[model samples]
Target: MAQSPGDGPKRVAIIGSSGGNLHSHGGDDPARLLADIARQLDAAGIELAAVQFVAAQSSMDHASDDTAATLWTLEPAGPAPTAQGSLSEVNETAGEHDERLAQSLRSGEIDGLILVSADPSGTNGKAVAAAAEVRAPASGTGGTSLATAQALGVDLVAGSGTTGTTSATRAVSYVSGLARRWGLKYRPVIGSGPSTVAEGSPWRRISIRGIMVGSIPAFIAMALVLAISKIPGLDFLSPVFDTLMEGLPIVVAAVAARRVSGLGEVGLVAGAVAGILSAQGGILGGLVGGVLAGVLASYLLTWTLAHRFPATTANIVTGGLAGLLGGLVVHFALAPLTSAIGDGVKTGIEALVEFNPLLAGAVAGLVMWPAIIGGVYHAVILPLVLVEMGEKGHSFFGAIDMVGLVMVSLGITLANVVLPRSSGERALAASGAAVNFGFGTFVEAAYPFLFADKRVFAGALLSAAAGGALVGWTGSEATAYLPAFVPPFIATNKLGMALAMVVACACAFAVTALANLHHRRKQRA
Candidate 1:
C-alpha cells in the first residue's frame, strides 16, 4: 500500500483478475500474480486494501464430481468462494453481491472500488449492471458512482485483461486520478469538519449569470447617456454625462466582483475602490481595481467567517475592513501603473489615425463583429471609441459601428427573408429588421443571425469593412456618439452615408444569401 502526498489514507478494493494462468519467471502461482499486481499499484501511488478475483466458469476445469471447486476468491488466500454452476447462477448472485459492495462504500469501509475485466466486453452484462446499480440514489451519495460507466458521475478507469501489465498499470493510474478529482470535489472547508459543508467549494459553484448581471448597470448607463445627449438644451449636462460615462467601468467591475463573491458588502467596496482608480486611470484602471478589491475582500470575508466570528457582524466588519484596505492600496499603488496604460492607448489610436485613417477604419470594422459577440464592444472597446469621439467629432470606430449595427444586420435579415429557412428563423430576421429600422438597436436582434451561421459572420465582416472604408475615404464624421444602430448620416452628410450603407447592404446580402443557397444545393445533391 502507498500513501499519496498531502492526502489522508484511502482504502481501495479491486474486483476481477488479469485472467488466464498466473505467469512469472518463477512459475504459475495465483497468489504471487496477485501480489505482483498489488506491488505495481503501490508503486503507482495506489493504496489497495484487497483484490477479489472472478474467474469465468468456462475458463475453469472441474477436477472431479466429489471435490469442491474454487472458481472465484479474494487475494492473500481468503476462504474459497462457492462456484456458480452456470452464467445464470452468477447473474442471480450479482444483485446480492452488488448490494454488499454498495454498503461497504457507503459505510466508508472502502473509499474507492475498481471493477477490472479480462473480457473486453466488460465482464458480462449482468456484472456491468451490478456495478452501475451501486451508483443508484438508494445507495446514498446521490448518483455519484464509483465507476465512469454511462459517462455520468465520477469516472472509473477500465482496462482489458488481455492487454497484460500495461492495461493493469493504466487502471492503477486511473484510480489514482479518480481519487484526486474526488478530493478536489469533496475537500473540507478550512476550520470546518467534512460533515458540515457539502461537496464543491463556493468559488467553484459561481455561474456565468453572476458575471453578466454585474455588467447590466453599465450597459443601461451607456444607453441612457447616449439617449440623453440627443435631447436639445441638454448640452450643458455634457460634463455630468462624461463623469457617469467614465465611472461606468467602476460600476461594472464592482457588480461583477459582487456577483462572483456573492457578497454585496464586498462588491460595494470593490466598486468604490474601482471608481477611485478609474477616476485616475480611466476605464481600464476601474476594471483592474475592481477585480483586485473583490478578490481581497472575499478572502478577508472567508477568513472572518471561518474564525467563528459573530454571524451578524462578520460580513459587515470583514467586508468593510477589506474594502478600506484594498481601496487604499489600489489608490496609492496600482493607480499610477494604469495611468501609463491609458495614455499609451490614446497615443496609439492617434498614431493609427494619423498614419492611415482608412486602413484603421477598415480594420476596426473587421474586428467589431467579434468584439460585439465577446461583449467587449460595450464593456471596453466602446469606451475607448468614446474617448476618440470626445477628442474628434467622430471616430473610425463609429463607421464600423454603423455598418455592423445597421447595414450588416439589415442584409442578414433580407437574406433570411429571401432564402429558404425555418419559419422561426424568418420571424427572428423580421424582428431584427424592425428593431434596427425602428428603434435603432440592432444588438438585440442582430446577434442571433450573425451567430447562426459562419457565412453570416463573414458577410457582416465584409460589409462592415466596405462601409468603414467609405466613411474613412470620404472623411465622414458623426457629431453624436450614439449606439451602432444609429446611421452615420446623423453626423456626416447623407450622400456619403447612403452610398456606404448601400454598398454594405449589397455586399452582405449577396455573400450571405449565395453561401446559404450554395449550402442548400450541396445538401440536395
Candidate 2:
C-alpha cells in the first residue's frame, strides 16, 4: 500500500519471478537493468527497500540465481537494498509464498513493488492479483504485465518487446509523477549510480569514480584539521593534519581494492599493506599496488576454491602473498618506470607551455572532453595532474583544465538550466550546475547533455579551447580544487584568468543554448 505524504521514505521491493528470464537487450544485462532502476529511483527520491526472489516450486532450488547476482552488483552502487530474509520456507508451496508476500505489501511492510519477468505467461497470477489489490503499478517485459497495468490505468507499462530497463524506467517515472502530484517530499540524491567504467574493460572493476569518492573524506579531514590547527590554542593539531594527509593513500588503496576484489576485510587489509609499502612511489603507486594485489588475490582465491581449499585459509594466504608481491613489484620495478614517465610528460607539457601558451592551452582544453570520452583522462591525464601537484605547489595544465574543461562544462549546464526543453532536463541541469560549482572536481553533471548531442560536445571543446588559450597566455596555475570562478583570484595572472573564464563560459553557454533551441524546434517539427 502507498504511504501518505507525511510518512517516512517510501519503501519499494523488486520481485524477480523464478520461471521468468530477462535476457540482455541492446547490450544491457539484467544486472545493469536492475542497477539502472536503482539509479532512477534514487533520482526520483524513492527508497528501494529490498529485492525478493520468488519461486512457484516448493524448493529454494527454483529461485533465480540471476536475481541474486543482480543484487550483488547493486551493492557497490550505493547502499545495498535488503534481501527478503523472512521469506517463506523453500518447502512451502507457491500459494503460501505469494500469501506471505501479499501480506507484507497489504500491511505496508513494502510500500511499492516492481515486478520483473521476461515471459508474459511466466508472471505469477497470485503476485499480479496482490499488486492489483493494492493498486500498485505492474511493469515487466511482456504483454501480461502490460494488460494488468492498462487495467490499472497507470500507463506505466512497457511494450512487449521492451527490456526490463524500459519497464523499470516507466514505473519509476509514474511513481515520481504521482509523488509530485500528491505534493510528497523526497530529496533526490546525486551520484547514486556506481561510478564504474563500462563492462569488458579489464579496469572496469577499478572504479575511477570510486577513487575520487574515497579521497573526499581525506580531503575533508585535512581541511578541517588544518583549519582548526591554525588557531593559536590548537597548534598541536598541525601534526595530526599531516598524519591524516599521509593516510590518504591507504584510504584510496582500500577503496580501489574492494571495488576490484569484492573480497571483504581481507581485501582491505591487503590493500592497506600494499598501499603503505608503495607510498614511497606516490598515490599512483599505492593505487597500482592495490589493484595488482586485488587482481592476484581474486585469481588465487578462485583457484583455491576450485581445488577445494578451505575458504578462510585460501583467503588469508592469497591476500597476504598478493599484498607483499604487489607492493614489492611497485617499489622495485614500476616505481622507477612511472617516475621517469611522469617527469618526461611534465617536461613535455612545460616545453609546450613555454613555446606557445595560447596554443598549448587550446590544445589541452580541446582534448580534455575527448580524452574523457575515450577513457584516456583516467589512464593518462589524472596521473600527470597528481604528479604535477606532488612536485609543484600548482599545476599549469590543471589551470587550463579549470578554465577550459570545468568552466566550459559548467557553462553548458548553466545554459540548460536557462533554456531546457523539458522540466526534467532543467532540473537535472540545475542540480548538475550546483554540484559542479560546489566540487569543481567532477564534470559528470554535464555528461547527459554532452553525450546527447554532438553539437554540444563540439561547442564545449571550442569554448574550452578559447579558455585554455587565455589561461596559457596568462600563465595561470591552480593549486586546489575549487569553483572555476575562484581559480582566477589565486592565479599568477588574475585578470587574464578571469578573462579566459568569461570567454569560455560565455561561448559555451551561447553554443549550448543555440543547440538546445535547434533540438526543441526539431522535436516540434
Candidate 3:
C-alpha cells in the first residue's frame, strides 16, 4: 500500500518464492534480483511499486514478507541495488498471505505483476497456476488471488529461468513487448519534476501515428462489412457492422484520449462527450476533439492535484470542464474547418483526375506506397477517401489504392512464394500472402522483400504507377477496400479495374522474381 505521485509511471508488483524445498529448486536470492527487475521495468518506462516474498513453510501455515520499504522512483536502479537492507527478514507465519496478495490485485493501484517461481508446487507457483483457471469478467467467470489480476486488467507476466535475474529479465521483455505493441511510452511526471521534454512534431506521432491507431477499428469494421456482404446469411448483420462504422468517431476519440491523457476515467468521459458532439465532422473532427479534451483534462487534473483537491472531486471537475470546453470548440469552430478541408481535398483530386487522368493516376499510384511508408496514407489521405465514398457512393482514390498498393503487394508476395530460395522462406511468403488477402487492409506481406532490396520495391512502385494510370484512364471507383479477387466485383469500372490489377500484379511479380534470381546468382558467383 505504498503511495505513488499523481503523475507517476506505471506501478508493478513483484512476487517471489522462498523457503519450502528452496535448495531442491534454485535458492531465492534477494540481492540483484529486485534490482534487475526494477532496472528492466525502468527501461520500459515502468516503475516497481512493491515486492513480496512468499514462503510455503507448511500446508497449514505460510509466511510472507513485505520488503518494499523504499518507494521505487522513476530513476534507473544501479547494478547492485538490493532489497536486503530494507526487506524485513520476517519469517512471521501467517495464513492470510494469499488474501493479502488477492487484496492487492483487487485494488486498482497495481498496474502490472511479475511472478518469479521456478517450482510449480511453491507458493508463487501455486498462485500462478490458480490464475490460469480464472477467467476475465468479460468471460463471466472469476477466481481468487491471481484470478483477480486477470479480472482487474492487471498485466501479469511469469518469468522463466533458474536464476532470479534471468527469470526477471525474461519477464521484463514481455512487459516491454506489450508496451511497445500498445504504443505506451514512459514520460516524466508533470508539474513537479524536471520539465518533460517535448515529443517530435505533430506530423509524426500526433497526426500520423495517433490517427492511424484510432483508424484501426474503423478499418476493421470496413473489412467486416465487405467480407460479410459476400456471405449468405450474415448479410443481416450488416446493420451491426454499419453501426460500428458509424461510431468510428467515438472509437477514434477514445483511443486518442487514452493515449494523450493517461488511462484516467476523466479523459475517457471527456473524449466520449467531445466525440458525440463532433460526429458530423467525421474522423478528422474526432481526432481534433479527442486530443483537445485529453490535453485539457490532463492539465486540469494536474493543477487540481497540485492544489490538494480531493482526487474524486478533481477528476469530476477535470472531466466536466474538458468535455464542455472541447465539445464547444469542436462544434462551433474546428468541426466546420475540418469539413471544409476534407471537401477541398476531394475537389482538388477530382479536378486533377479530370484534367489529365493518366498522369494523375500515375502520380497518385506512385505516391500511395510512399505515403503508406511515410505514415500519411491513413491520417491525411484516408479521411478524404472516406468522405468521398460517403458522399458519392464510391472513391477513385480507393480504386487506385486497391490496385496499386494492395494488388502490387500481393504480386510481390506471390513472387517470393513461387521463387523462394528455401522451403522455409516459401512457406513464410505463402502464409504472409494469405494473411494479406484475408485482411485486405494492409500491405505488410510485401514488407520483407521491400526492406530486403531497393530494386524490388522500386519495381513494385513503377508497376503500381502503370496500373494506376490505367485505372485513371478507365475512371474506376470503389466503395470499399477489398481483396484482390473481390474488388472487380464491386468497382464501378469492373473490367477496367480487373485489367489494372492484373497488369500491376504481373509487372510486380516479374520484377521481384528477376531480382531474386539476380541475387541468387550473385551469391553463387
lDDT leader: 2
User: In candidate 1, which residue pairs clash?
Assistant: 148-156
Q: Which has the higher TM-score value, candidate number 1 or candidate number 3?
A: 3
Q: What are the TM-scores, per candidate, against the unseen true structure? A: 0.51, 0.52, 0.60
- Per-residue lDDT for 182-234 in model 1, tens only? 44321212111232134124354233344434454454455455546656876
What is the clash count for each candidate, in the order shown?
A: 1, 0, 0
**1-525 in candidate 2: lDDT tens per residue?**
667657877666555533233333211244444555676566556677655444332222344423332122124444343333222333133334455656766677656665554212232345455566776554344345556555644333223323222323223333443345445553222112354213312245676656655554554455446545656799898788767656665666676665565454556667887878777666667778888877765566545533434333455666687778877888888877655655676688789899998788889888888887788876666656655544343467667767777788789999999998566899889888887677675677789999898999899999989888888888876633565556664566768878887898899999999999998999999
Cα error, residue 114 of model 2, in Å, equals 30
Local distance difference test, each candidate: 0.51, 0.61, 0.59
Rank candidates by lDDT, best first: 2, 3, 1
* Cα-based lDDT at residue 388, candidate 1: 45
Q: Whole-model lDDT, candidate 2?
A: 0.61
Model 3: CA > 4 A from native = 1-205, 226-245, 373-394, 421-424, 441-444, 447-455, 479-483, 517-525
Off by over 4 Å in 2: 1-252, 302-310, 373-376, 390-394, 416-428, 441-458, 479-482, 485-499, 510-525
Clashing pairs in 3: none
Clash pairs for candidate 2: none
Residue-wise lDDT of candidate 3 within 350-374, one digit each (tens)?
8989999999899988998899989
